[model samples]
Target: MSGNDIDVYLEPLVDELKQLWDGVETYDANKGTTFKMRAALIWTISDFPRLKNLSGWNTYSGLACPTSKRRCIGEDADQDDSYWKKRSVFFELPYWKDHMLRHNLDVMHIEQNICDNVVFTILNDSVKSKDNLKASKDLQSMGIRPELWPDEGGKYPSAIFTMSNPQKNVFLKTLQNVVFPDGYSSNITRCVDIRKRKLYGLKSHDCHILMEQLLPILVKNALPSPVSTVIANLSSFFRELCGKAVNPMQLGGLSNHVMQILSRVNDQPVDVTNNIGKTMFPEIGKASRAVSHFGLTLMERDQAHRHVLVNCEAVVPFIDTFRTETKRKLWHQTRSPSKIDRVVHAEFSRWFKRKVPMDSTLHSKEMKLLACGPMQARCFRAYNINGYKFRTITKEDGLKTQNSGVYVSSNTSYASMRDNRVAVGSVPYYGNIVDIIELNYSCHFTVVLFKCIWVDTTTSRGIKQYHLDLTSVNFTRPTHTGDREEDEPYILASKAHLVYYVRGEVDQEWSVAVHVKPRDLYDMGGENEKVEAAAFSPQPGLNMSAAGDISDLQLTREDDIEDPIEDVSDNIDDVA
Candidate 1:
């Protein structure tokens, strides 16, 4: 097909393939066949550039309908609605069928060969130039000596040395026996080299062997097993290898051997509840040569003690007295209170005094009292008794009264009353008190208490809001100086009201006036104004009052005998 003809066919195919890919689970096993079909489609579209267009015979036009079996299709007919529709339908059927077949094939191929392919790829990459260089450098840093020989180009050899504190001769003997068993021979160099390259060919296995050999040594020191049992186990293991020369071959074989011994040791009946009594190792026939040196020193001390005689006749009483005094001193020290105990007690006393004061006057009253103080004004909203909506205020509506009744107490007298109550909307009343005192100045601050009560008038069943107590209410005062204070000194031009409603039933509410104490008003500005006026004013003269009264009399007479006032008079001059 010509390039344009091919392009027309492939563009739709590409778009359909992309849509199919998005609609289906792309990674599903069944979708593998679709990928193969997609690949085939791509290959076919790529070959579009190779097809030649025949001009005179109209091969392209013939090829447009493939029934003609021509090499190229005409672009004009390919763009035709009916022709393209037929072409699309023809292509879609095979595309879907091939996609399904190839997807299944891909699933099987992935299942059978993907894991091996991943493994080969990893291994191949690991052996690449950079990786090899890194491996060589790591081996060199680990002190692996390089060996060059005529037969072998080069190889790195491993080094082995005694890990623990070793006696030179004993270590030398052990090394010699390990490498040159049955006397020296031609293979001595190779054997020595192999021994030196302790962690060469079987590096992973060599590490495991070393770990196993060190297990018994670590267990002897670290096991929570009884001391006697641990000692006995070590003794038994050493006894088993007493006569046999220790060598690398034997060392490598120790992991299985020691494990076998440990398994048998564990199998021997043990009392789970009384493990301390259980003997880990039975008595061995021979002793370990390494332990014999220490054992001899202990034996010599015992023998020397057996020869010594006790001479406690004269000094016995003095020694006894000294021991008694020392015991008494220790006992007294243990019984005495520590410095930390005293410090804790002092801190507790201070904290108790600060948090719970000794002066009862500083304490708050049992019942919280909400009040309208000097600088505090009350704003209230009223609700209809039967309806959910708040009562609307009108110009003709008369003032209403709501009383909270009397609260009688022995320590304090508290009651609430309200008058001239206007019906405001359910929204929060936004108004400010003129002055508020800082917390430091106020002896006791007033809190605006709110309680929500749900009353069902029909059934006369009311539910007080849950945990709706005065203590839980969070009250915050203004932080800045510019804004007016909510609690301040002010004359109540009208009665103050306690505005509240049922929880979530703000639409139904009422207000009652509660008189507040003078102390509750936080009037910081009132105190400030008095201080500023005192500082700026002139000092008063006591004698000046009499003179001021005489002046006042003269002015009164001038006002009483009013005549036609002159343009400029002596009385006016005197007033000025």
Candidate 2:
């Protein structure tokens, strides 16, 4: 497919589609393709059919058979029809025998539908006259006049398209005045920055931002009490679920909104978002109905949860291979375009997961490792108790997390320990070198799942380290012993989310010394301190089995001879 919306290939899958549509018993002669049935795990996207059909440009629903008596969506509608197309390729799917929901509503699709309709209904003439009037009156209250807005040609383009030059100028000024949380600056969101681009082609994520941020600001105190409350309340749910942490609260809120949406269905166990939205605003309801038409409601579509989720593990390589072969550069036009091609996919678990096979000897796995780009010096200082080594991370989305070195949080005390945060260069904190495992999930910056080990100071031995792994995101550490001031080190252990080596090694059989024991001079009663084993250094013969792990710190002579400018490795194996 090209930008011109043409199927550039001379030979199409026309013959194969014909057999699938007809459901003819194939004696292997009719079907030319090697695989009679290739699986399609996810089937919903714009212009795409869950059954055998195309998506986007050049969509083909074999021989449209929508008689006046029956509307067969399989061959007619992109959405719901009066009748299900039994002749659809749904029966042709070989994997359907394994129990799978062949078609379903994508969350992205529903949310995008809600967003697009919400904007269009209020700003365009598509909605019922009453709803439009209410929306217009609300806008007028905010000093906005409907007459000043540009007249769109029926199709509700981006709301920006409705604005006159002066109106757009005002809108731009208001948008520029708004601010967002975190250190993020809204300066880049200015009209000047986007002058080269047309707002009409705004993607779903952009609409989401508009719904969450700018929409609320624009509609504040403008609409009728009911309209304002409903819109705001509804938007809150959408806002929370946007490309971020899906906490219990967010899930609950979504369920609650879904229930309210269900109320419009009147106790029937069918999706009625369209019913409710349309009743509220006919256009909004239509938009939602269109989405629901994608399949049966989210609930009814997959009753037994019968579906195969082809995760990033499978999808990423396929996508990467496509880009590599086609020599196509990745999407960089928008902030984070989540369209079919633009979205980045990565697994929560790494290739070298403790549970999963870590054997990177496989060519594909080796390529992923090689694609891990540059290594941090901290990796050279990498220590492994038995086979469990430190994690190596590269970028956060497309941006490099570490400019000079690994991502060390400057928001020290009150920092998020999970997302690229560690008290690097701080003493007693890995003694300036904590072991890390490179998290596998990084294609998109949805979540960073990696592990790091920090020396737990709770025990004087310092060997009792906190095991910060994937599971410990919200687990807050107990208040530090003497942390008083806000800026002081009130290290939340939950924030510490670090992990200690609990598995993969026998403590008695393999007790390797990593760093020197931090002994208190007062506890020793002024005894002269002996400095024999330096950090990452292995002792040759003497193994202090009687003492704890750190007490047996020893350096090999060769390692001892060289200045410890570089991180020493493997030499520590001579612990005894």
Candidate 3:
């Protein structure tokens, strides 16, 4: 409540306090039973006829006996009865009456209001006519075409839209190279076509940034000389108004009303409150002002941090988060995202059928099944390592195939002759498979297993070797022997992997599938780091000192150097 309304406003709070004070009076009569407001600022009390100003009233002695039992007189105030006994309820409230210092004049609030008032003065409809009139006169003086501007009394658009499209283009072209003063580089970023932007899109800070930081340089050439000078003066006024310290000389133009409002500030620098208006301008202390005055804490940083560190339970999927009940339509048919791989398969099938007819049969389901008959989908025992179950490893040629083994007891590396067997880490450990066993429990499905013996394929690895039965040979294609020496090696059992077949790569004949690992799918990626370390190792001739020395890389200017390619002359004799 600013003026006359102060009495009407304090009624509700006074009633609430009276009831609380009554309860206190019933309990403890000795204790002074009274209630009051915590924090408040009464402004422009002099304007209200019903109110009496508290500022003139002394802190201790001088008294302007207020409307309440509490006497809000000045300190060392003269006790003469000449002081006005106005019926003001502001001094009546013990809360506000007791604490006079808490009643303050907010400098930031006044500055922000002044800025908006200044902005509206230049932009409002009343002033726009005069601005357009002056612009027309200036344009005519410059010999610009009269057709660019509308006739007098026409509905006035903003100053930016007054020019024709070509004129606007010219203005924008020149705006590109507009330079700002030192320490003011923010305008450099806005050196684009701001012609299309509406004035309302700008915030209070944006307005200030344009006026103080950029417009001083921009208006020098872009606007007419008179308009430029006015803008410069306005920017200067704003700069002074929004400054940390107020200058009475800079504030002469402001009316007595504004000056009276400012008079509330009794000291050299006016003090403002923690209202939202003050925090927007940089000259005001922003959020720090609120914290200093009212102990207000902002949670913007806390909220952002909370969002970044959100738990899995708190995270909502994009589809779920923004789901709409309205049935939406699309140009193309929607497919299940979960079965996205199937779409790729269908697309390729259609492509093959249309683009290459003869290859269609080769790409058929029947043909693929014929080649990969034994490689049908089947789950195998996969040993878990590091909490990850890797189903396959890529074969040398990049195909997916199971890691099968044979008993190469003598031929395998790290084999003991006494045991006549190799450990699991050996490549030939699974080389021997003498028998096949099928077992089924009463309540279970068929379980197939290999009953095996050791093998000795010494020719493959310079160890020992032994051949297998015809049945066993077909069952396990142990190609690491005899004339098939160039065949793919038996993948080491140390890198034990389960595998799958490539459907598209299959042929008419039974194709032994080559394994390809999806390296990215594994929790632990492929052993690329280990391979890279060995590849770039220092050569034998170079010592550590030679490699590390800066002097080793000496640059020499070779004046004697000739072009490696001889430039042959046009004449055949000279070319030779």
Candidate 4:
């Protein structure tokens, strides 16, 4: 609507709102009673064009901003009375003139404008380029950047900010090939037209991801160092701004930092980077594979039950007591440490029920339930809980997107070979879930466990952070393969976080680990935390033997090496 058209449409709504504010009788549906009700219109939200129609402001002129008007750009900005279009219909309301806030600009569209301009100007689009001939003429009129002034032929000279044809191709192709985790954003690759050297049909969220995350990575060597650095800094600023939760105290500092980044880009001369590279991979789609299921055998059920018992908190006291009592008896004397551990796990459930009294003061309801032991577990292909969706490797095998990747931070004792002393610290382990099982405790409650294939996290063999935000792991060297009795593969499903590994550009052997945040949950902390990206290291040429089935592996002890028992409770936080 133009001119007073919006006012004509709003007249009836405004009159009704005024009547409601003065106290209109509202009916109580449940009580069948009528009482005086009052309501007030706080604010209206819209984009710049619609905002002008609603607020009777001239958004097309120099004094366009509704909040600051002539003072928006500077105190000396244009403030001519000719800029006035009309008085808003909202001002007709009694409280409208006195209202502190009456309109809010939508940020989604604002992001589009900023992102589109940056991309178009860099790509040097003739149609959408912000640094067109007119812009250069304006610069010439202002007597700044005389080198960028239009020539005698009225043709604008090429600016340093614009990308060369080769550079543009590399940037566009790299962006087109880059892959993101599932549900992170739409297919950004589809938005790029490499042949045309332009981006098209990008949604608001696509621009958001590109501005905050993908742009910095793709711009690395495509642009000059000064330009790329400015882009990186700007992206970082937006990343913090768009974080789940932001600290109000940091806003002043962020504002200053953004201004500095903006000024640096204009002042610094371009130093174009060379050796731009792009990595390409084929896209994957869902594949139909044969799925098989079978009931757990008697021995398999017992082992699964034992795995649950080890991680169960209420059963910890019983395990300690059983271990102590078994040490006193001569039964474990002839058995190896591995065999004894296996025997203890196998027999503990039967012994606990017979030896421990159900109604005893020490045995709480939880303890009693645990002592009775869990029945046979039910396997799942996929399970969702604790704000995460987890799938087994078997289930995710043929899928393009992975939901089976898992990572857990836990505390374990690290024995130093130099001093022969043990030091306990928290270590992050990366892996993929091989199986998911839900064990029932006689209908009282159930516990879900994730059997994972963990990468070797030892000092020489595990995760290595090569640079800031670059972490890599070798999937070939798995740690907990159930090869020895000490290898524990089961962990409480609640403790695992989601992460997906992407193959590195240079090192094909190592994959970059991208951490995925749980959706629909607010951090509620003082600041939004950042997880560094993990890249894989180059693998050594070593032929390792294949691992046998976990359940069929024999339980054996290593005579000299003593495996450290992890202090699980300390490392993990209890998530509700």
Candidate 5:
């Protein structure tokens, strides 16, 4: 029902509450005695606009603050009619008028409205942005923000509050590159469009997450320093307000920040003199190379060392022996398939490492090294090995997917060539690094391994290459992880090459892998180390440059302005 119709439905509940407040005869079963019971309804809750129905207070206009004493505009200029549609039915309860709070507006809708206004305005949405031709005209009529006022030709100039085309692309791209932890939040990337400069389909919780978490990050170097600072402060305020546990002592400080943010958001022309010493322009597109802040415990560290050791090339022979022995021991047990595999993964490494050391016959260097096992291992979310940058899934948060893709090739000798010589065929495995670990073998050497999550890579099931030289992999197809049975999940970090997985243009389940080669590095029949090191480097599109000032940002095209905007679409297109 509509807000006005809600009163009719609440009338019966109000009457029942009044009768209960007057004191009704009741039986006290616990005490085995009769008593009079009394109660009263203190307040009602609803969304903002419904306040008019609950408290008979019109809260639909700019002067809608419930605590204030402002009158809504009437048909005539002189008439002052406070927005009181009718006396609420609850007011019939005589005590209702004396209560301090008659109705409570749900904060959910409040936060949604606040976030929507800020995001839409910053994005300069055609239908939703508040800074349109009418708003500019309003500013002109109010004789304020002269720079934002429409010119003589009725053309709106670029306002400092709204983003230009280049700035918008950067802001959206930052969000597009963000990879949140699993189940932390929904995939917000689907809402962003760098090419169209639009973001839509955000729900209430989505807006809350964006406001409390992402707005501050996106505005960092994309907007002017003053503007970005004010937005960040406002976002912080919302975050604190909506926290699970809020300290009463901090409410005063939070209130103060709200006012400060409001004053700071009022746009003023660039005051070069005031910002002389401070950095006026932001370093656009420059990401920090900060190390990962997470760490593994001692037990986890030890387990990682064992995993590396089993995948080590020097331990291959010993691993095969352990597997054979395990299969022989379990052959007559009638164990389940899963149980047998579990036993192998759990006990094979430990038994082999300990047993091989006690065997005096194993005196070779590789055998001795395998018997002792790898030393305490170091874990990293990102590492540079074989001259190629590798990042774990967690470390890929703000970077292009290039550095995380890992490819390894294995050769099989089975067929004969045209000259009756043995033929070698190469098979490539593709996956993304989930972990990077460095294992130390005494003081003499160290080995880095990339623990990856692989796609099946089989011809008919997982991978396909188009005539256009584009390769796509079906991630839905699973491959055996080394944690289970035979296939090991790890590869020597030195053997991994780099590629980028771009979302497929046609199907969502597939991703196209794009390979990159090192810049200015070529093979001259060199050593394997140099050759592998020359395989990967940063892509050219990642290079970034800084601009001088906020004013240097270009304006939108004339056609884009509903009422004559600056004709700079060509320049905006160039920057994009």
Candidate 6:
């Protein structure tokens, strides 16, 4: 037949075969069908030798050719059957490259299908080999069969066998050189080989076992470094198949797991400053900051300790003297600054007296005079007692007193007792009364006095007195005139006093006054109230009196005689 005639006749047949091949459904039972069909398609293209030489035609032929009738129809037609065979006769023999290329393509298709099925079985947990076999039977029942073989007869054409041999060699070589040479271990290499064998109809359970082992390796290897390095290397080696049909969801989950592992290993605070220029992923920065803060707080909590000490010196004095009843009363009462100030001053004064020294050079002459008992007494009478009495007299009485031998006026009576019984007409009985003068100074020195008073009233008649003596005290260190000078003047002064009649009041009323050096008498009402309260309700072991009262009374004639009658009347009236 003419080449054109043959082509014309074969064209419709080829078209029908192509349609059939395209329509042929894949079968699970017939594992080799797809590979066989692809092989037959390559054979059909080879039948048209002239077309095969065209540029880009080989690819087209493989894609478009019939899946059957690629060789001669007659069983015995060999040397003279076609021009292609004639050329093969002229050339030494048919080369394997052309045949192997098509065979490898077929083998590749089968291998891919096998891998897809295996992955499906692992991931889905529903599909199984038994299901695959059933599916393959269903396809066969529908008149669909593998296209490479013309019929179910045992013999395959010589050209087709030649094609398959080269195909096997090319496939195995490609696997060894391109896929396996990347240093995967022997076990993995054997696993992949089995997968290829399965594609060629060598069914074995080893492929499933290998796949099972491969899954953990993939998961382990794809994790973040450095622990996952081993697994990652293995996973990367399988990248060829992994790239083709990986489950994106599973991959994403794996990536997240890897990220979690990395986050734990590198538990440093994320540098938020680094994100200042990045506006696209604001959420990432925020999340990182939160994680960093959490880590920081956790670390701090993991490594913490504490120590405490309280100065109990001030409290030590009150420890034995404090009373539960007094504490309860004080707790119920609102706090007063006067009380607090007194306690604080007392504490500081005690500390200063015990720990600090005084300098005498800073004292004025007047202060020195006040420090001496006689001088202080003399000054006190001249300025306070005499002056107070003198001011109380009216102008008429004052003139009279200037002439009278005795200042018998009601207001001047108290003064007459202290000053020698001065007859106004005669020389002053106490002698020339030095000019009464008052001097004021800072906290250089002070004298506190106490006196008893008695009242003969029907409701009350008793003597009450309290004495608190404080001498010149310094709060800070004495200053020296020169750093090297051993004999530096004292920066403070000392004071003293006699209590003969420092305080006096008639009746049940008595009050003490604190006279600070250089002549000032501060009423003890405010200054001593806190001390009086504490002394009255002293704490446990320190309470001096069991009566619990700060003010006590005792009847005594000395108290009555010392109290001024008019003053006593006034005090009684005030107390009432």
* Best of the two (1, 5) by TM-score: 5
Summarize candidate 4's per-residue lDDT along 56-108 as a digit string, tens digits. Answer: 66787634544332232112235654545666777766777677678898867
Please write out the lDDT profile of model 2 over residues 1-576, one tens digit for every residue: 232222233124444544564455535556654444432334433322322232221223322222212232333446554233234333344443343333444566567667666655554324422234445455556454444333443322233224344444454455556677765433435423235212344466666667676666655533444454556666776777765677875564476465454332221121222122221111110010111111222321121011111122222333443333233334344332222122221221222132123342222332333234212111122322211222222322364321111112222221222222233343233211222222121221111112232233222344333332111111123222122211112121112221232222443422222322222323454468776765442543334344557756665554456555754455566553
Which model is ahead, 1 or 3, in terms of TM-score? 3
Winning candidate number (TM-score): 4
- How well does model 6 score by local distance difference test? 0.28
Position 280, candidate 6: lDDT = 14
- Whole-model lDDT values for every prediction: 0.27, 0.34, 0.35, 0.69, 0.67, 0.28
Shift in Å, residue 149, candidate 4: 1.4
Count of clashes in candidate 3: 38
**Worst lDDT window (10 residues) for model 6?**
301-310
Q: Which candidate is the best by lDDT?
A: 4
lDDT of 3 by residue, 172-207 (tens): 455456665777444533535346511233344555
What would you estimate as the lDDT of candidate 5?
A: 0.67
Candidate order by decreasing TM-score: 4, 5, 2, 3, 6, 1
How many clashes in candidate 5? 0
Question: Which residue window of length 10 is worst by lDDT in model 4?
Answer: 271-280
TM-score of 5: 0.39
Q: What lDDT score is found at residue 566 in candidate 4? A: 83
Clashes of each: 13, 23, 38, 4, 0, 15
Let me know the TM-score candidate 2 reaches against the reference structure: 0.27
Q: Which has the better TM-score: candidate 2, or candidate 4?
A: 4
